[model samples]
Structures are given as structure tokens and as C-alpha cells.
Target: MAEGTRRELFTILETSSADADTVPDGGETPVNLSMDVRWFEIPFREPEEDEEQDEEDGERENGCRSAGGAEDTAGGRCDIILVTGNGIKHEEEHPEEERYYSVSYNCSDDSDIDFSDMEEEEHASCFGLDGDSEEEEDCASPHFWGEPDQVISIEPFSVLSGPQHSLGSDADTRDYFRLLFPDSLFEHMVEQTNSYALYRQRRSGKSDPHWHPTDLREMKAYMGLNILMGVNQLPDVDMYWASDIFIGNAGFKKTMTARRFEKLTQNLHLCDRESEPVRGERGYDGLYKIRALLDVTENTMWDSYTPKRCLTIGQGAVAAKGRFCPTQYMPSKPLKKGLRVWMLCDSRSGYCHRARIYVGRASEDATVTALAYRVVTSLVRGLEGKHHHLFMDSFFTSVPLMQRLLRDGLYACGPTEPGRRGYPEVLRPCNVGKLSPGEFYQCQRGNLVATVTRDSKVVSCLSSNSAPGLVGIGPDQEQQGEGDDNWTDTPEEGGVSFGVPRPLPLLLYQENMRGVDLCDQLRDCYPVGRPCKKWWRYFLWFYVNICIVNAYVILRESRGSVPPGGCNGKHFTQRHFRVRLAQQLIGDYQGARGMERAARKRHADSPIEYGHRLERMSERSRRCRNCTNKGLRHESVFGCKICNVHLCRGGCFSEFHK
Candidate 1:
């Protein structure tokens, strides 16, 4: 059976090979090979006859279509057993045929799947700072800032006025004024002195701060107005253009006196020392009728301010060579002033010191110093137990002066001038009711012996009792008993304690230590002191600039920055509005500098002229020869450069400036 199958399959292959000329199909062959053909039994899945299957798969001669039978392809799973059958051609109906095998395959394109269109969602979200994740429940939010080390690095900046300065309107600067001053700051200065002067000038009958004077009488008031505005920002400010102030250069000599001061209320008056001429009282120190002018303000047209105390001092002007007739009481007045009214010369105090030896105007240093001493003089009444400061250098450090301050119930502290005497050489130990000796040693003020001989005796002396057996080398380096410098030798037959004759320092002790060290140490014990560093002045300048800038900001509006509603609401200007912020700015910078000096110089020549006027007081005014020639001859120029006008620089220039 196997031999027959093999012979049949081999015959089909041999038939094809023997006839190489058969072109059975239209397809052409590219290359041809004629060779022997042998058919191995290849199993077919459709059960084709073995010979027919071998014929379908027989080798082509020149161009034959059949290689493996078309139906001979495997149907199901087929596994061919190579039992060394005579040929591969096989027919099988049975699943287990010896020459048959089973094979199966899925009809797929066998193509590779491309992931190019895989459609992955785009990446999102940053790397997490929010701690809201469930796994991060214990974690705190990460910080991006607020770390300590990042803040303090110095950044260099080129600072200057920016372009916004030009854009700054009167409205803007006015708001700045409100931001700076507020009512509280003004009230603070008001509690000190009651000398406030404000002038009103109306354009279209509407008053503005920029108002200037137009008349001779009002012009004098304007001068006073200008004076106050000038010094409002000084080291120790007392006067202001539109508020009450103390009348002084803020000198150390100022003493506080609480008396009912006369309200001028639009009335002008001279001091009692400057009364009407006594036919020969003019031109003398008692002759230049010092007066006060009051401008009445109608708050509700019902409130009237009356002059409370006015005392006549000396009759007749110094121009007429007048002498003060002594009096102890002041004149009482209930009189209110009308517009342009003038009160006769009257003094605020019964006894007065004449400026006979001094030249025209008061000096800043001398005046401020005098004011300070005056404060010390009145300490018992004005200061009580409260601390008071008396800032001073060594120039005023006299031992008697310090002792005098202590006697007045005020503490004393200050730097000492060099080469002076009466300082501590006594390191007397503390005893009795005084500090313990060890405690006294702990005091760092000084360690010299004999600072106060017999510390207990000194303590008793401080309690208003005179101490015995205590003496020292005086300021003159003489014995303690040697001093007319302590008190005047005007012997009154009455035995009264003027004061103990304490030694006065001729010159203060120059600092052996630093000025600041001395000042700090002294401050711990007393009220007066001085800074000792070379850079102290620089420190002072720093403080001064802050003061100046603050002053400039507050007072900037006083220079007419406040318009009715205050340049009212950004852009509107009303009755009280002024448009020139730059004018105010520039003026604030220059800010009436040297105005006092200039004013002083302006009046320096007046004293000589005043002397001449006083000498001729009895003569004639020529125009008002019979009308009491005491009337002021307005002699100066109070001019407004903008308006091109002038008014009296003296006398009653009050109403005119308004």
C-alpha cells in the first residue's frame, strides 16, 4: 500500500519535469530551473486522495500553477507525523490517520499595533505646596516666605524727590498736612504759652491764609504774624502765626507765671514803662511805650474777651527821658476792644527789668538760657515733684546758681566750665540720716574728697538748716567765707535770710571725662546736662532734621495749604483754598531763615532814631502837634512782593494785613 502511494506521487512530479514546454497559466516566470521531483507525503486536511494531493503540489516544469493543493491546506489543528512515509502527499478523513496531522490559525492581518494614537491625557498640576492630601494630614503647609534670614539684607536705593513731586497737588500736600498734624499735636504746644497770632486776608471777601496786609496799622500785626511763623519750628518752639504762644526767644531765662494775662482783643497798647511823655520823659529807658494790640474774634458774636490785668508802670516815653514811678499793683480792666482800637501803655507786671544795657534785639542763646534759669527760679510752684530737664553746657555752671536752683526746690545738673572752683574735693563719707558710707561709695558721680565737708552737715543744710564747721576753697581759690559773689552787700538793718552765701563757680570744671558720660551721670542725679561727643552735634542734627521735617509738614498747611475743605476732597478749592503748593514747599525749605536776624538788624538803627524821637518828644508831630504826639510814626516797609503793596511796618498794622 505504501509503495503504490509513493509511485503515484512520484509519477505526477516526473510527468511535470519531463515536459518542460507546458505554459499552463498566463503569468510569466522570471527564472526557471528544471530538476528531478520527489514527493514526500504531506498530509491534507480536506481528505483529498493521496495521488491527487500529490499532483496538486507537484513541481512546475516551465510555468505550472499548482504547488500544494489549495484544499490541501490544514483545516483544524493538524499535526503531521513524519513516519518516513514514501511521499508527503496525504489524504485523511480520519483524525488519527498515521500520515495526517492537524493545524489551525486565526485569519488576522498579522499587522503590528501602533501606540501612536494611544491618547494619553496631558500632564497637570505643580509639585505640591498644599497639605490637603490624605497622606499628608500631619504635614504643615510649606512656607515660601516669612523666614528670618531673608528680611535684613541691605538694599541700596537711589533716593531723591521723585517725579510724583511735580504731580503732587495742593490737595495732595494738604492731605499730607492733615496726616501729620492732627488736632492733638497743636493742643500740646498750646498748653505752654498763649501767644497765637493769625492774620486773615480775603480775596473776594473770602479769607485765605495767603492773605497779606494793606494798611499801616494792620501791617505791624502782620510783622508779628511773620515773626511767629518764622520761629515756629525752632529748637524750643513757643510762638506760632495762628495760635497762642509764649513771648520769648525760648531762652533759658524763661520763668512760668500763671496770672490772668490781659487779652488785647483787637486793641493796641504799649507797656506802662512806655507811657505818655512827661515833657522830658522820652528817649530814656522808660519812654518807649511798650503796648499790646488785641484783635477781637467773634466766635458767636456773643463772647466778649475783656482785658483782665493792665498796670501802668512809668508815665512818659524814654524819648522824653521818663523815670518809672514805682507801684506794686496792676490796673484792673473789664474793657473789650473794637476794630482798630488802641490801649494806652500798660505793663503786665508792676516791677520790670529794663533792657537798658542790651542792644536792640534779644539774643537766641541768652534768651533761651534766661528762660531756663527762670524756670528753675519758679520750680517750687511750677514743677512740684515732677521731673524737669535743664539742658546746658558749662558756660552757665556757677556753684551759686546751682545752689540757688536747689534752694528753689529744683534739682541741678550741668557740665562745668574748666578752671573753675567750688566743685567736690570733699569725699566726706555718708553718715547719720544720709546714705550709708558703702552706699555713698557706690555712687559713680565723683570720688573727690571734700565735695561737701561733713556729709551729715551738708544734708542738714539741704533741709533748710545752716550747717556749721563746713568750708571750702571758693571759686577764687580763697576761703569759703570770702564771697560777695554769693549775695549783694546791700545791708538792710533787718535780719533776714536772703540765702546762705554758697560759693559760685567762677568757671565750670572742664570735663576730665567725656561730655556724654558726664551728662548721663548727671542726669541720673539732677536736671541739667550736656552731651559730650564730637558727633553729638551730628546726633542733634539728625533730631533737628526730623523736627524740621515734621514742622514743615504740619506748618506747610499753615502757609496756606488748607483750602476751605482742604483743597477739599482732592481737587476742589473753596474760600480758604490756596493753589500754590510749590510756593509753600519752597518757603518751607527756606522757611523764614535768618528772619529774626534780619528783623533785629532792621530795628538796630531804630534805637538811635528812637533816641532822637524821644529827645524831641516834647516838640511837635507837626501834623498832630496838639493831639498827643505819642502816636506812632509808621517808618518801615511791610510789603508784599506779589501784590506790590506796602503798609506800616510798625504801630497798628494788624487790621491792614487782614
Candidate 2:
């Protein structure tokens, strides 16, 4: 062999031998004889002329010639020999098998080894040494973590198609609210309520004589009273009808009697109990009692308004103290023990577009990612091909989910937990502390980008819709900076300052992920919810609050301009809208007073002894009660002195008395 190549081989073997000796006892001993010594030649004895000719021919056929030709082999085949620390010898007859010798060394322990002496071909040949070696090569390749600083393409958002309905200038608060809760739903409620009352009466075999079947008008009035109760809260339900000068709400007494309102509340039903499936039946539903109401409300929300480009997916809790199978306990949440609901809402207006009640986990082993995927997919079912960007939290963000959303033409951005699957190993929590405040590291896989940034603390985010780069603080943060003297452009010790670099995905998540929270805020402002023994009642009130918030948002948007007086303006705020809506819903609907009150009024009037006497009415004529009951609007100027009420002077007075 050549002297130069021989010296290099000897140097590598000596170094490997020294390294092997330093290995601790009972520890892994790896001898790295990494070199370009493929074939070697050593002269053991002289050969005959016939043998020399035969060796040259064999070398040519085998393509294993030594560096200086067949003369270096001393007219014989060359063989490579390697000796281990334990005096074991490994001899290779073929030069092609030399790579196998390198494979025997533990590649994991070669972190400090320099590969500069090895050719590109030799480095490439070491792929089979260890799986991690191949992974290291991949990590060094360009675009291995996807193209650096890649920007996601943004699609122009537009409402392509939805229910077409327009409100004119003459529209009232009731008109706007009916867009979300129409008259048909009220009729369905009335039907189910009357049926349930009849069923109860039959089962008891004794019907109360005071019970009267409710119609659509009375049911609407009943709903109106419920809404008004939210605005004028009292300690007890009957207090709204109290006749005391200090605490009485006369409007409640004017609309419906306390007894009748209580009766309607007791019999209120959204679905027929007789048709409910048995507990162990195949088609049993946990929410069957309020299923119709939920369906109608959800369908109406989708049909009423189209959401904007940015959306949010989150969970909400409806407080309840009833026996429910799907109640979850979340000590961190405000409504710690209650029913859970998943919601998808608009970021700009906080309008709920879709919702799903959490019944329970589908199975015991169901993963968190799987449940989040199902919820996001189910809520955004009809919104495909619309290019809506969704923001969520770590419970819902995962690498596979982001990829799936990208494939569906949807986009998502959110913070992710470090331990979540497919998170970049280079951006781990341990490395986060090494980054300076406002500094970030990102890795991309196709459209999905996983980013870790150091702010107040280490925050990791995964996104399919945002670019991977630093951005300045947002406008809201700038506003906050004005009040706080500590806010500045300069960085602090292990913390971020105002107007510093922030990850784009983190910014987007912060800006657009509060839709559900905003919805909760609006619902909590004048909460219509109250504690109830029935679990479905809590859900019913929750959906009602959602509908009211959504309706108010729609009304504000449809108006195109805010009134001058802020919340005090007519139909400006949710409070004004709800009050006006309740008034219109209760228009002209009256309930019968109790028999005691009627007899007391009769006894008080009988002592006057002014029976059947006619008296002239004052200003404008009122509608005759007898005529209005017959669907006629006959005005009356004459009044009965005995009754002290307006009536026609003829048979109408005698008919009202009868």
C-alpha cells in the first residue's frame, strides 16, 4: 500500500485504541476506527510468476485493486484486519464489506468525532450505523423543518351564501329578535306545554278547574315575562306582582297575574314527554327534554347571520344543580360544576354560529386531541371552503389537527403545550429559557408552524394560518402601555416589554381567540339564568341568553350606525333591545285574575247600587270589551256606572254583565 495511506490508517487505529481504554468499567466501549481505508496490502511471502499473473487477473475481476496497483498486494489478494480492545480480530476478505466494520461501533457515542477527514461518499455510507445518525443528517438538510420564515397565504373572505333576510328602517326590536326566535318556535312550545299539562291531569285522575289550555299569544306573553324578570330581578318570583308601593312592578300585574304565570312556568315543555325514548333504548337522548329548543335555536342562529373570517372554538359551562349525567367539574372555571358546551363563534361580533353539548366522552381511552378534532370539525361542518381562520387554546391545538384543517381549506392558530405530540424537539420548554425576551424559535411542517417564544413566560404556539416571525406589540397592548409606567420599549430581565418583538401566531391567537370569552361577557351582563331543579332548564336559559346576545349583535350590525346617546338610546344596547322586545311580545295579552280578586271587586261594586247606569266616556273612545272579544273594534263612549268600565250603552253592557 501507499505510505501516505498507511500512515493515516495507523493514526486512526491508535486514536480509537486510546478512546476505548478511557471508557469506564461496565460502561459502553465504542472504538471508532473511522477512516477511508477500504483495501490494504501487506507482503507475507514471495509468489511464483504464474501466481502473480493469476492474482492480477483476480484483482481486475473483483475491482479491488490497491492504491498502487497489484504490486502493492505482493502478487496476492488484499485483506483488511481490525483488532478490538479484547484482542479479538475481524478480517474482511472483500473490501466492499468494510462499511460493516464501521457499523459495529456505537454511533451514539461519536458526538465529538470530526467527519471532515471522511469523504462525502463515506459519510453517506454510514446511514445504516444508527437511526439517530440518519435523523441528524435530515435535521441538517434545508427545509427539513419546512421552509424557514414561511408566510401562510391569506384568502379574501366573503359571505358567499346564507339565509337572505333584510330589516328595513321601520323594523322594531321585536322584528329584529324574531329573526333569531321566530313565532313558529313559540307555537311549538305552546303545543308541547298544553299536551304535557293534559298528560299530567290524566295521570292524576283529577283536573284543576282553574287550568286553561295556553295558546300562542299567552305563551309569547309568558316568555316576555321571563325576559322582563331578567331586567327587573327580585328575590322571589311573586315579588314582581307584589302590590306594595315600594317593591311592586305594576307592569307584571298588568301583563299577567302571578298565579297564571306560575301555572305556565310549571307546565312549560319543549318536547312531548310521552314520545321520549326509554332509558336503555337505542335512540335514547340525554337532552331529549330540551332537544327541540336547542335544534331550533341553533338552526335559527345559522340561518340568521353569516360569521366573519376569524372565528374561535372554546368550551363554556352552564351552571346547574340538577341530576344530569353529563355534568363536569372544572374547578378553575367560574361555573365549576355544570354542563359543558362547545361553541364556535365570530371573533368580531361574538356571535355564536354553532354549538354542541358535551354528553360525555365517547370512550374511556379517547384522547384529548381526538375529542378536540371532533368538536372543531363538527362545529365547522358547513363552513368548509369558506377560508375561516379559527383560534383555539392548547387543549385543541395539535400538529395533525392543524394539518387536517389546512387540507380542508380552513386555517387555525393557537398556543400548544410543549408535551403535545409532534411539537418540535428543538423548541422544547428546556430551551425556551435560553431565548431572550421577545425572541422566538420556529419550525414548520408544510402549512403548520410550531413556534416557541419567551415573553412573561415561555409560550409555545402551533398555527396553520400565521407566518413565523417577530412582530411589534398590538394596539391593545399599546393602549395598556399608557396607564402603566413600567411599560417600555426596552427589554427587562427574563420578561418582555411593551412594543417588543412577538411571534405572529401568538399575536393572532391573542387577538382573535376571545370570541367565546366575549360571548360569555355579554351573556353575563344581564344574566337571564337562574337556579332550577330541572337540568334542561339551565340549558334552556343558556341558549336563550345566547340567542339574545346574537340577536343584539345582529341588530347592531344591521343598523349600520350607532345612535347618539350610547346605551341610553332606544334599541341601542342589549338592555334596551330586550326591554322593547319583551313589551312588544306581551302586547295586549292579558290573563284572568284569581277568583278571590274578582269576587272582592264584585262585592265592592254591589254596595254602590248604581247597576246598569250609563255614563259618558272622557277623551278618546276605548275598544268595547265585548266587541273586541268578537274580533271587532267597535268604539264605545258610554260606560257602566256599576262596573266603572267602558262599554256600549246597549246590549254590550248587559252582555259584559252576563
Candidate 3:
């Protein structure tokens, strides 16, 4: 053969190398595996071609070796070289044929391969699924998580549809909602109102009340249920008229002067009435009557009762509670509307922007008086005998107003600054001297009842029979029989009085006790007035305001539509879920309706097509399983009768139809 340049031959292997510890090395010979590799051209020599040997023997066997031949071969006469000229030793003893085991492994290079760990020019937007590796080329393509935001698209479905067995999906709220909503609760409201009435009757000893001022003043001469409550109940609030204890205000911008209010009629619209400077008395009766009308819508039914045929209404309101300036009122004679209509307006303000439309027996005009009557509609119909306290401030604490309150079967009391003067003499000095200096307007004076010195006014009063008493419950009156016997009976009490008055009644009667916290007292209220909004923030402010004003304002923004039980945080999640479910239902309806337009829409968005696809998919899924089941084994007539889907006994044979 002609001589040619030599080329090198080497073997490259891909193997699962055994860890260093897996290999046995008793002597600890140095083994290096990660050495750098370099490529080079080297001279190689071809071995002489060995001819195939023809077997003269009958069987294939090992080389014939005589005793003499072994010695001859050991002398290095054989030329199958085991040592290289590079001084590297080669294995002289090769693997025995019997020890050899062949293992065949087949795997695709790309299968289960994690490209995330590979070294490559990563194009995040590119799917890398196709042969094309350019991201710019696929810029027009829609991909999940590629846009600014992404939302999972689910086809519309109804909770009520399908099987009733799957109600657990939204069971946390739906069941309770159905029970606690309009249906059951409507009737329940009437029941609760009646119960409240019964409670009020037992608490107030006067089963029947006289609206006459003369009767009220005469009653005050003697101890009323309020004076008795404090001595009856221990550690109870000294409550009298609910209004006296409750903080209340009316946020009204005097739009129409008092004269305009006196002559108010259906002909005068709230908007048509000028924004009369409310700086002077705008006739309090008209405005007040209007307020009352608005409040009574839910509670009263004025069809039957009539002691006072002519009741004056009051009015005036600001849009928001940001700016407040207290204004006085004058009752212009007696203007009556058994269920009269007067235009009461809430002026342009922030609160009005948020104010919702509240209707009560819609009359020609909606006013405060209308609201008041509406508030009592259900109460009057359900529980006519309930007594309510109509507390007021020095502003409305005139003896005459108290008489008016008595006419309505409501106990009236407030800080009698200058107006009220026909109450019985009280024990304690006026605590809030800042309100009215030295003179008291409604303190009890002997049995005849005198609106005496403010300094001598009772600090607090209660109404419940269970409330504590004044004289019977001193710190020394412990339960021991000795403490009980030591107590002296008063001749006024006939000396045969039950030495221990009922605590609840006594609590309501303790006019001698410390005055209540103005803020805390208004915890229960239908707010009437409020300070401006610029002055407050957060729920604390709202709560504080609610506590301060007996104005009867509904907390609308802070807590939207208080649940049946009010703003209870415990039901927060449930309420939220209810809202979500409602939103879902609405959205589904809209989508379904839009599709109708989509069918007609020539240039509808992709979402429309997606909706159609979803509808088709839903239709397919709802097909029968037993009769003509698409993905089912052959069956006779056991298919889903309603949906016409093929189903089997083994797979949900008892599914809901429709």
C-alpha cells in the first residue's frame, strides 16, 4: 500500500459514572476524572491483516497449546501489544466472556429534558415548542401570562342547575342567605317588633300614657318607672327617656325660613322652596314633623290612633354633615297631616351624593315627618303597645315638648337648659355646668313637679323595672340578712316596701347617679344630625358620630346595607361571598345575552367567539350518558333521559336531570 499521512482514532463514551465511593479502592490509588481535554493529530499505524483460520477439527475450541508452546509464548514471541509507547499501561487481562452482560437503553434526547437549566439564548415569550426560535415573529400571538394581566376563563353555569347533591360548592353562604333574607325575615321582623313592644310595656309601668303636659308633670311629682329603674337593677345604666341619654343632632341648612315651613303644603316642593337663611327660627314644628314622617315609615301605621288631630311637622337638612350650625324652631300653631305630605329637601352636599332614595308610603312629598311615620309602620301594625323614649337636648327640652312627647306615649327628657320647667325636684347638682350655668329648667320640685334649679337636677334616670334603686342599694347593702335588715324603710314608700327594689327598675330611676357618657349613650340610635365629614375618617369616626347623634343616620358607606343583625364582622366573609356569587350570576346573564348580539354581531370581539365555544362545550357535556352516550359502553335504554347523554350504572347513575 502507498504510504499516507497518519490519523488518530479515539473512543468517546456517554456513561452513568459510578460515584467515587461506589468503586472499591483499598490501596487508595489516585483516580482523576475531570481532566481537561485537547485535540491533536497523531500518527497511527495499521495492523497487519489477520486471515481467518479454517478449522481442521470437528469442534471450535481454544488455541492448541502444548507444554512446549506455553514456554515459547511467554518469551514474548506473540505480538498482540498491551503496552503503549506513551508509557500508559493497557489492560493485559481483558474481561472474561462469561462475566459480560449487555444492557440496551433507549431514550429520546429531548424527552423529559429541562431546558430551563440549559445554556441558550432564552426568549421568554417564545413557546420554544416549534422549530422557530424567534420571539419577535410571534409578537402578535396571544399567550397566557404574557399580557399585562390574565384571568382564567370559565364558561357560565348555574348553581341551581345540575344535581342538587353538589350544593356544597357554595354551601357556606347560600343556605343561610335563603333563610335569612326577604322571605323568612320579613315575617320575623314583625315578630321582633311585637316582642320589643311587650318589653317596653313591662318596663314602663304606665300601660297607657297621656299626651297632656298636665298629666306628665303630675306623674313626675311621683316617682316614674325611670326613677324606679336605678333602684331595681344593680350595675345597670340609669336610662330615662331614650332621647335624653342619646346624643343627637340634625344636620340641616335652613333653606326655608320658619314662615315658609308653617305654610308648607303639597304645592311647595322641597326644591322650589328657597334656600331661606336658616339663621333664625324656621318654625321647628314643620321641619320636625317632616323628619318624623320620614322616620316612621317602617315602624308605624297611623290609620287608627288620634289624640292630637293636628301635629306640626319639622324639616331642614344638609347634603353632608361637614358644617353644622344649630338653629331654633318655632311651632307655628298646630299643622296636622294624619299622613301629610311636605317637601323636605336634603340640600346639595357630599352626604346627599351618597344618600340613597328611601321611600315610605310615597306621598306628594317625602319629609322627615313622613319618614318618622314610616319608621313606625311595622311596629304599629305588629306591636302597638311598645313604649319608646324620645329624648332631646336643651334645644327641645321645653316643658311643652315633653307634654307633646307624653302625648305620643314616649318619655321625653334632656338637659333642661332654658326651655323645659315642669319636672319634679331632683337630688344632684347639674354635672355639665357648661351647658347651663346655675339655673336648672326641669328639675323635680316637690310632688307638684317644678322645673327647678339646674344645679338640683337629677344627673341620670332609668326606665327598666329590673334596674337598681337609689336608697336601697348603697355600697354597704350586701346580700347578708344583717345588711338587708339594717336598711330603713321610708314612709313615702309606705314602710312596707320590698326593702330591695328590683335592680333593673332602680337603674332606670337613679336620677342621683353620675351622668352617662354622651358618646356612649348614643350607641343605639337612628341618627338625626352629624358634624361635617372633613373632621373625621375611618370607622371609628362613623361609630363615634353614630354614638353622638340621635339623628338616626344610617351608616351606609362604612358598612353597606347592614345585615339582618347589623354590622357584625363575623359574617363578613359570608357577606362578601354572597356579593361575589351575585356578581357572578349577573355577569353570566350579561355574557349569555351578549352572545345573542354576538350571533348578530359581525365584528364581535374574541371573547364572544370564546363564549360560543363555551356554550357548545356545555351543550356537549350535558348530553345523555346512558342512552346514546358518546363516550360510553353500549347500553340498552338507561341513558340520561333529560339531557340525552349516555351514562352507565357504574358512573353516577343517579344524576339530577335538567
Candidate 4:
């Protein structure tokens, strides 16, 4: 080999000693290993001389040459040694190049390898691996291929055990029905509905006859009717009671007067409670009872309608004005006031999987770690053993949470704090400006992986399931730097521009994080909630609307009907669905209230009438069907020539005609 090209020789020691595995006692001398080896040589070259070397010289010098001259003093190989104690000896092989030698001890040798060794720089040298070959090998190893470093330098997260089973198949037609209507959910609802049974047991014979006690069946129906009416948004009780309006046909017994309706609403209760009549208290000391009812109903909805695939956590703001309103912060009014709620919703259907009201930091000891763990775990509690992916904002994502979730068989991806402890410093935002738009840095420690990409803005994310892969870029219209004026000149190609490339993590984040916002948008349209003095009443209305929205989503999917103009369906909008639900609930109670009366009455069409035929008819005073049914009286003025029925002239002349 060329003198300058061959630098350092690496020795491979093969041993036949049985005591090679044992370590010596601490107060000791370095152990000597006697080993036999077949010497191997790898080609190497100095950086400056590499360009000038001939290719023909490299091909002929492929194998080790026998030791010769002062340069090859050890037969082109050195004796292998094992060292112990603090000041172990190492040979100075080259005076020009700095070297650090790592010893691999597989055997104890009797031949001592001297550390007080030196070789002149001009002497013939041994060859080892070249830089290009070493780098290519390292890049191909999957263990630490794209990572900045091989070790997790920060404090490690507390990881849990893996789940015993896997998530269900990825097919859309998989058995998701059981999740939507579990038997446990039904059992809980039944228990809640029958809670009023305790009140009946306490009744005494001395109670007033006028004290209309609540029945479980009747209470449920009354609650259903109230939800229905709320959706319809009647101006007042009088409008619902109007005989001419369609709402008047909402079912009850014929004896159900306006007074009875008012009484039913005022006395409604889900369960009996201990009487503590304090003045000015909301619900007259029944607030606790109502709150309990809300809690049970909301939980039942969650259990009964579990979301299938991707879950997202987002915040919602409900406007309120009262001393009772909880102190909370929203992006719109951070210093001002509103009620805040954290919602976990399904990305596809926009159905809320779970929700929790956010009180101030005092109530929950609100650190980011504790809050994130609670919110994510509670929302995905029923999803154990199912490897669902969770998406969230920066407020609730951390390395520790990602590790915990992955161990519990759930995967999560979201923007998180790059500077937080345990996060890889290489993925920090401060290092992002050095990267171009399509470039990113990735690092992995165990199952947790962190990625930072430079898009229009720097995005840092931690994911357990996804890798830092690139899918493609978004359309040019969405690019931040472009303008409409730039695209207008391109007449033949239409006003379009190519988009910037996007990484997979940023794309997934954008797609999955809008679930809660979708829910907010749906509820905002045709809102059923009205202004109320009591705070809990707003929650009552809000939940009722959410249930309806969930039901509508299910119905749309099951019915398989396409709506025009981007409405829900051809025949049914959300309002129409609400009206139909109200009608069904009330109708099931007693057929629509005035339906039977209206059906039995004789009538004539305005544009088309029955043929006229003159026949002798009775002149006696008989009741007019329309007036008699509505509790009005009129004598017969003339007989209909067609059907021989009597009718009054002034109002009933055209009412029953020819």
C-alpha cells in the first residue's frame, strides 16, 4: 500500500481461553491475553493524498501484507491485549494523527501488550476503514439512522406496560355498532330513569289529594316534550296553546289545558331530593338534583355513542353573564369572561366523545402535565386495548403524556413545547431557521418520536404512531406568501400556482385537529339554547342540542341520502329533524293532540270541489261539524247539494261547498 494512504491498523483478536469472560478484582493490574488471529487489512487514505492516488494501486493492495522493514515490525498485526485499573496503557501508533483506542476484551492473554509504544510518522503504516465506507454503513443502520444522537439525553418518561390485544381492523364496515350502543350504557340509563321510585315509597296516606306526585314514565315523557319545544323555539306558552297553530297538535290528552302544561314544566324532576328551601337559590334548592341529572344523562350519551377512529381534544367557549359564571380564558377574550369546556370529539362525525368543564387552577391544581394526563385518559378510558390515535393542541401535549398514552395502547400526535424537559433539543424552534421549508429534524427514544418541520411557521410535534414522512404539499392558493395578483397574468393555465411541499406530521395535524371546531360550528347554527337566569339551564339546553346533532349524524349515515346545496339531506334539514323528533315523542304519547278531531271533520277543497246535485235535504237545526268540534255552536242554514249535509251560510258557505 502507498505510505501516506495507509494510516492506522485495527487488530481483531481471536481467543481460545476459557477465563476471557471473567473480570478481575478492583485493586489489580491489567490482564494479559494470549490469542491467535488471522490478520485482516482495510484500505484507508489521508484526506489530502486521496485525490492523487491511482485506482490501479487500490485494486492490487486488497489484502494484508506480511510484516517487513521497520514499518511492518509486528507482521502487519499487533498482539491483542485486555487492560484493567485506571491508567491502562495504549500504543502511540501515529505521531501526526490524534487517536483514541477502545479495547474489546474477549480473552485473557499471557503475552503482555506494551502501552509505552511508538512508531515514526514516516514508517510504512497499516490500513483501516475509510471515511466514506464508514458513513454509508452507519446511515443504513435502522437503530439510529435519522436521529441526531443515539441516546435520550433528557430525563426519561415513566412508561406503562403494553396492552394485551390490538385495535380492531381498519375497514370502515367493521363491527362498530357495539361501541355505539353498549349494554352497560342502557343499564345506566334505566337506573337513572327509575330513580324516582324512592319518592313513591315515602308517600303517606295523609298527603293532599291535590299533590300530583310524579311518575317515572310520565317524567321521561315530559322531559322529552320540553326538549322538543326548546328545539321549536316557541315565543311563549300561549303560542303552543293556539288552536290554529300546528304546534297545538303536539300530543297530550284532550283535557291537557295550558294550566296543566305550565304545572308539568314547573314540577319536573328526575329524582326526589331532600327539601332545603332557601330563598333566591337557583331551582329553589333543587339545583343539586338537576345537576346530577345532567351528569348522568351526559355520561349515558358518551357511553352509548362512542366515536370510532380518530379523537381530538379542543376547547369551547360559551357566552354567559352572571356572578355564577366560572372564571375562564378563551382566545377571543383572555382577560374578559366566559365559561370554558374541554371537548374530545370524533373527527369524522363531529360527535363529542366526552367533555369536562374547566374550573380555575385552584380546583384542579392545574399544571400542564396533570391536566393533560387527566383529560386524555378520561376521554380514552373505554378505548383500552384499541390503538386509537389522539390529536390535540400545544396546551395538552408533552413527551411524558405521549409515552404514557403509547404504553396504554393509544397513539397521539400534536404540537408540543420543544424546550420542555425530556424533549430533544435538536427539534427546538430556535434551530428551525437553518432548515428550509421542506426540511425537518427527527429523533426517537423508545416508542416516542419527536419531529420539527419548517413550513410557513416552525412546527414541533411528538407522535407515538406516526413517523416523520412526507406525503405531499397543499395547493398553491393556501401558500402564505403568494397573492391573487401574481396568478392573474397566467390566462392559459388558469389562475393557479404550485404549492409548497409539506411533511406528513404537519398534514396529519391539520386534518385531525378540526373535529371540535366542527362541533362548535354545527351547534352554532339554529341554536336551541335561550337566555336563562340559572346557569345549569344553559348546560341543559347545550347537551340537548348535542344529542340531537349526534343523532342526526348517525341518521344521515344510515339513511344514505345525499342533500342538495350542501344541506344535510334532500328531505330533512337539522331543524326538520328536530321537529320530527318532537312530534314522534309527543305523538307516541297519544297520537298528535288535535289530530283525531281534525281527521273526523268533513271538509271541502278550495280549488277543487265535489260535483253539485240538487236533492231534497233536511231543514232541521243541526250542529256544524267545524264549529261543534272547536266548541262553537251554529244552526244549519242550508244543505249541501252534493252530499246532503247541513252547513251555516256566513262562515260555512265556502267551508263546505259544491
22-130, model 4: which lDDT tens digit per residue?
Answer: 4231111111112121111111112233432444254323211210121232121211111222222222233342211112222122222221111112211111123
Off by over 4 Å in 1: 1-381, 425-658
Error of 3 at 362 (Å): 17
Candidate 1 overall Cα lDDT vs. reference?
0.23
TM for every model, in the order presented, reads 0.20, 0.66, 0.22, 0.52
Q: How accurate is candidate 4 locally (lDDT)?
A: 0.48
lDDT of each: 0.23, 0.63, 0.23, 0.48
Best candidate (score: TM-score): 2
Error of 1 at 447 (Å): 14
What are the per-residue Cα lDDT tens digits for candidate 1 across 121-228?
A: 221211112223422322122121111111011111112211112223334533433232233332322321122212111223554332121222222222222223
Stronger candidate by TM-score (1 vs 2) = 2
Please give the lDDT score at residue 604 for candidate 3: 23
Query: What digit string (tens of lDDT, one per residue) describes model 3 on residues 560-610?
Result: 344323235644432243333233222321112232333443322111111
Better of 2 and 4 by lDDT: 2
Q: Could you arrange the candidates by TM-score from highest to lowest?
A: 2, 4, 3, 1
In model 1, the worst 10-residue window by lDDT is: 146-155
